[model samples]
Target: MKCIVGLGNPGKRYKDTRHNVGFMAIDELIRRNHWELDKSKFNGNYTVEHIGNEKVILLQPQTFMNLSGESIKPLMNYYNIDVEDVLVIYDDLDLPAGKIRLRQKGGHGGHNGIRSTIDHLGTKEFKRIRIGVGRPVKPIPVVDYVLGNFSEEEQADIAISIKNSADACEMWLKKPFLEVMNEYNS
Candidate 1:
């Protein structure tokens, strides 16, 4: 089974925050695939879609951002999915707003959600799609910046990125990850 996990805090308050861009991408994927995350299990919300002979599982951890692994680990275990078949999508403050990058494996780069995931999984060999939320404009606290809503102008860019990220997820089922990365990471 191929698993796509989106990291974000759970709650209506965090719905449109920069930190929830991961959730937004997953939302786009669900819309594109015409599926609903009707099942609640493994501390998360999930739904499966069978594409050709492959089963694709889309997940949104309800355990929040910091403890995302608490949900992902159990779900992966229950589904008998390997680390290599997992792709985590989350926000990245290091890149420009709305920019997206794909990596085969890497450290968390100080993202608490990614940190938790790496810790629980015991490896960084899983795939990742980092959607840029942009750095703070000034000396504002990082927490406040990430939890803040996007600017009016940024909304457009972020929306486009979310759509593209969803498109990339669909491409994963059809091509090698390296090829998908090369095509989308540019």
Candidate 2:
């Protein structure tokens, strides 16, 4: 079994914020597959289903962004999924909006969610899909900027990135992750 985790804060207040792009990508995947996150466990909303012949669990941790690992480690333990079989999706402040980057392993790069995940999972060797929300162009605080909703101009780009993220995930189910990265990252 494979696990795909999207990191974000829960609740309606954060629904469309820049920090929630990971959730947005998961939503797009669920929509494309006609699946619902009908099960709740390990402080996460998740669904188990097949993409092609591979069984996959799609998870959105409800422990908020900073404590995401609190939710992911348990679900993974219960499912007996290896660290190698996991893919985490989250937002990246460095890349431009509408861009997505895939990496097989890396440090959190100052992302609290990824930091917590690496802490609990005990490694930085898992796969990742980072959706770029971009750093604030103005002088706003990082927290406020991440929590803010996208501008109308950015919405179109975000939409496209979300779709591309979902597509890359689906392709990963059928092909090697490195191949997926090569195809999508280019």
Q: Report clash pairs, candidate 2.
A: none
* Tens-place lDDT digits, model 2, residues 1-186: 999998899999999999999899899999988999999999999999998899999999999999999999999999999999999999999989999999999999999999999999999999999999998989999999999999998999899999999999999999999999999999
Alpha-carbon runs more than 4 Å astray in model 1: none
> Which candidate achieves the best TM-score against the true structure?
2
State in Å the error of residue 14, model 2: 0.2
lDDT of 1 by residue, 94-126 (tens): 988879999999999999999999999999999
lDDT of each: 0.93, 0.95
Q: How many clashes does each candidate structure show, in the order listed?
A: 0, 0
5: Cα error in model 2, Å: 0.6
